[model samples]
Target: MTQISIGVPVFNGAKSLDAVLECLRVQTFTDFEVIISDNGSTDGSKEIAAGFAARDSRFRLVEHAHNIGAKNNFLSLVEEANCDLFIWRADDDLCDPDFLAILKRHFDSNPELALAAPRVKFVHDDGSPNYEEDFQILSDKIRPLRIGDALMGASSSWIFGLWKRDALRHALEITLPTYPYVWGWDPLTLLPPLLDERVETDANALLIKKSISTARYRWQVPAREMWEMRRAFSRTCFIAFRQRDWTLAERVIVGVYVFRFANLRVYRFWKTVRAQMREWLGLKRRQRRSVEG
Candidate 1:
């Protein structure tokens, strides 16, 4: 069996798919398999992936007849993995050739590590530097963080990290059903890993995440959906609270985290309301001026 599995889920991502596949092809670590899942794309994404598979014996392509939603596609990729380690790679993202090598060394040496992630370097479409004005966060070494701190800092960056296949599978099986396909659902999908005490991160920029338009998670993907997701996430947290492993102090910290999350939601709702009100008032002013004229 392969030591690592890289699953790429694509839908009309032909434009950047080739570059991503090529990045994988040149990885310093070769004991890996690439599984590309095409979500019924008409934009030659399937052909691009197929071509890569043809050239690279390690690359495999899976095509779906219907367009399954993004969440399902992601979960399916994990389910298809057979290796001891797995990572969900975006078709539009680029990874450093040494990404797998660095992760492999750390994971193989550290039996207690549940998830291993590298520092993320954001780049433009043309491969130019992003965040030029801001100093990049650099890490000279890989280290583990407390579970609560990791969960608070969790985002899409950590979600793509290398995971122990069995741990990831169990996490997904427990968390996916609670995930609502709404705005900012990525962090929710990461709850299980974030709660694990053995998460580690390296400061090396082993992953280059391209800031594509569709890659950004918007907060406006239907209010009902957002509400449903928050509800589901809260329920899942309570379920987590019942775990025998967590201490009373840890459970209290989790409760505090949930409270903070609720406050964040309220803040977002007010911000949305204020923006809508401004738009509505602007429209009224325009209509009145038009009527007078």
Candidate 2:
């Protein structure tokens, strides 16, 4: 059996599919299997995945006739994994050749560590460098503090990290049904194992995340969307409360962390509101002055 399984979930990602597969083909760590699940991509994604599977015995392609939603596609990859160690690879993201090797070393050295990931470096689609994230490691010895640390500091990209298959499966079971939206899926799924087990981040290993320039800005999002995001955060907090294994004090500590996170979100929301109000007032004043002149 392979030592690690990398699950690649693809949906209409023909543009970068070949390049991503090439990256995997040349990984310094060769004892890993790549499972690519193409979710009914009308693009040439299926052909690209199949091409890799044909050329590389370690790479396998699973084609779905219908487009399963992105969440289900990701979960399906987890279910298909045969190895105890697993990592999710997005169709467009690229990682250093040694990414798997570095992460594998951490898991081998520390059997209790549930997740190990590299610090993320954001890049444009053209592969130009954007900013790198200063990701805080969530390895606190105190379990409650670990939960708090995950709540406040964990990056969503950590979802792509190498994880113990069972821990990841359990986390998905807790997160997916609780807060079913795609907006906060990463942190929610990442929270459970982080609460109970160790997580390590390697500054040396680099995962290049593609930053889309045309995506809507935070302030441009509608009020209803913002409210739903807040609701998602609250639901994530509820997941902590549902942990029957946690002590009351542990639950309370996580609750305090959640409260602080919520307060920060509210502060940002009001700040955006004030900025929009000022812009509107200035626009109205300009119209009045033009009419008087």
Candidate 3:
């Protein structure tokens, strides 16, 4: 059995890490390794990973000297994984026991699929899922292409999709900067469009449970503050699109563009530009030093 490398990136995710690990243990597909890349978590999350590593030969952990930011942390783990098959699981999410098995079967059956994901079901921290939930944006299932239509519409966890190691690396080459950090990978999902890979939506769900119970993002401290922003964005869009107001709508939309389509589809142009500028400045400084030498 080939071991699939599951890349999990975490930062100060103590409260929710153990449950995910527990879920990982029960996975029906046993041939897999869990690689946790630590992003300088202050909490004892590393200890949690260490416990798992001690118990399971398939579990391994990597620590960053300092926090490499969220996005780079993800790339660092993905790039470091030894397996050709990979899936990204966040510290804040839970998986069904059959996740690896279902996904792997699709990988073996459809040799052409660059990306494959099983049905994704979301649950609260208490493991409650609502069938009536409208998950247009954050659900992980994307509209399939002509050939990939079978995997479309609530069929799979394509939202938290899986990719061939090489395919993901190539897509990252196209969409990711050499520099890494968090807060940017969401928008980069657009790279899948560029790769033209089909998503397998027909596979059974790889269960996805929300870690914190709330939609808070920072998950650092005073976490609810993150949700307040979400509530504000949702209200603003409601007032703008549904209420037919325009005065502050555009400004609000632009300001929180990322949160527009539920935070996954908005343009990261400005943020990406700012990141590039930092890289440029750093490179220029090094070049000047070399010239002076």
Candidate 4:
């Protein structure tokens, strides 16, 4: 078995799949298998993945006849992975050649480490630099502080980090019940490992992410959907909080953190609502002026 399994869950990712695959092919660390899970894409994604698998012994393609939801596609990769170390690679993200090697070294040096992620550089679809983010979480031994730090500012990029397979599976089991919705899934899945105090980050190892204007998309979602997302986020935090064995003080601390996190989401939801209301009013005014003219 390979030392690591890199799972790529893709759907209509033809535009960037080739480049992503090339990045993996040239990685300085060579003992890893690439499992490409294609979600019935008609946009030539299947052929691109198949071609890579045909040429590289380390690459394998798994086909789904029908389009499974994105969440299911991600879970399928985890189920298919064979290595003790696993990571989910987005079809559009690029990693430094030494990314795997650096993270693997961290795990090797610290057997207790459950997850290791590098800092992330965000780029536009056209390959222009956007910004860089440090994968920040309090590395404190105190579980509440770690959970609070993660809830406040953990980068979603951590979801792509190299993880001990068992830690990842355990995290997913705790977080998946509330994960059917798209928003806020990453932070919830990341909390369990952070609470375990075994997650680490290296700024030198880099992941270049292709930004897709996700912030704008989130704002555009209907207000009702945003409320549903907020509910899911709250439920996830509650479930995660209950799953742990905590002292009374730890429970109270976690409760405070969860309160803050929920309030933050609620604030964002209201902001989105106001933005949409203004947009709708502007559109109405434009229509009235056009009619009068």
Candidate 5:
């Protein structure tokens, strides 16, 4: 059995898919499989994936007849994995050749580690720098983190990190139900801590996230549709807080964090309402002026 399985979920990602696969081809570690899930792309993504699969036995492609959305596509890849360790690789991201090799060593040494991730940086399509770094600088050496620290450090950036397959599957099962079609699954990262799986971090190892470009735009969900997602994130936080056995101090800290999230949501909702009212009043005034003219 392969030691690691990397799931690549793509939807019309022919542009950068080749580079993504090429990085894997040159990986220092060989015992890995790349599972690509195509979410009903009309572009040349099929040909690109098929070509790679034909060229390399390690690369396998699964095509969907219709668009199943990103969340399901990601889940499908996880379901396809048959390895001890797994990671979700976005089509636009890049990893150093030693990325898997380094992370694998950490997992091999630490049996309790549920997740392991390297440092991350965000770059543009042209390789120009965008965000300074993807994750907070927690430490320089590999170290185990408390559940709370790990949960706070997990910026959905860890979603792409190496994970124990069974542990990850279990976490997803508990957390996925909390989220709907498309919104904040940020709380899902808290699953490791919730499931009592330890998390490890390596500030030196690197994963490069290519920031979204004009050619790679994401589908924007409307504001009205996002309330459920926001609530889901808060719900996930509460789930983690309740599931884990923490000290009274930790509970208080987590409680404050959740309360802050609720206040922020309320503030955003109020702002949205005020903006809508202004727009409606302006429209009414324009209609009156037109009638008088």
Candidate 6:
């Protein structure tokens, strides 16, 4: 068995999968396997993945006949990995050769760590690291407000992180089938780790990555998909609260709706238009801008 499994879940990713595969092929840490889960990709991803599998024993392919939902497809991918440590990477991203080498050593040194995440460096279209501003953004959120205080707020977390195999299984059990979250995987993955284990963050810019295509859970994804996600998000929050978490859960529920206030589609634009106009006119002090810009 490999020392770790890097779960790469892809969808119509032929355009960028090869770059990622090439990066993996040259990894200094060779004792790991790549679980390439293809979710009904109509593109050339199958052929690209097949080429890699033919040459490398570490590369394995799991094919889904139809576009199995992203969350379930992801679950299926992770379930097939044979290692205790699970590292998630988008198909279009690149990883530093030392990414796993450094992370695995930490696991070897401190066996109790259930999860860990490293500082992610956002890259421009040309692939240069956006080091100047990205780190600042990460530094701001690494210490988010206590979950309860942020209630009526929003709940979210970074995904390119390492997870202990067992921690993932526990989170899966809490999933609800409300038409696609399959168990609040997004919010579940985001918040549950904060409860069971302290997720470690590193300054090492090991996980080099970018999204080559729009995927559910990103801002540009469909609103229905997002609202569907919020259902799971809210449900997870309730579980977190009833399970005796004093602050994080309730606050997270509130946060998910509040942050997702517009996305929830609970309030009509015209109905809220008057209210929003009043707030806008009354408040000259507060403003929100697009963060990615």
My TM-score estimates for the predictions, one after another, are 0.81, 0.82, 0.63, 0.86, 0.82, 0.69
Best lDDT goes to which candidate?
Answer: 4
Query: Residue 224 of candidate 6: its Cα lDDT?
Result: 45
Top-down TM-score ranking: 4, 2, 5, 1, 6, 3
User: On lDDT, who's better, 1 or 6?
Assistant: 1
Tens digits of lDDT, candidate 4, 1-293:
68999999998999999999999999999999999999888899999999999999999999999888777888889989999999999889998999999999989999988899889999987889999998565555566777777666667788899999998998888878766764566667877776666788888889999886634234555656666777777777678778778899988987887767765744266676775686667543122111000
Q: What would you estimate as the lDDT of candidate 2?
A: 0.78
Q: Write the per-residue lDDT of candidate 3 for residues 141-187, one digit (tens) a residue.
A: 33222212221222223435667888777656654442132233443
What digit string (tens of lDDT, one per residue) describes model 1 on residues 83-107? Answer: 8899989888887788888877778
The RMSD of every model to the true structure, in order and in angstroms, is 6.9, 7.1, 13.0, 5.8, 7.0, 7.9
Give the residue spans of candidate 5 off by over 4 A.
134-149, 194-197, 213-223, 258-293
After superposing all C-alphas onto the true structure, candidate 4 shows an RMSD in angstroms of 5.8
Q: List the residue pairs that clash in candidate 5.
A: none
State in Å the error of residue 17, model 2: 1.2
Q: Give the TM-score of candidate 4.
A: 0.86
Model 1 residue 62 distance off true place after TM-score fit, in angstroms:
0.7
Off by over 4 Å in 2: 138-147, 216-222, 242-252, 262-293
Residue 57 of model 5, lDDT score: 95
* Model 2, residue 78: C-alpha shift (Å): 0.8
Residues 234-281 of candidate 6: C-alpha lDDT, one tens digit per residue: 555457545643467545554554344323323233433454455546
**Cα error of candidate 1 at position 34, Å:** 0.5
**Residue 139 alpha-carbon offset, candidate 6, angstroms:** 14
Clashing pairs in 2: none
Highest TM-score: give the candidate number.
4
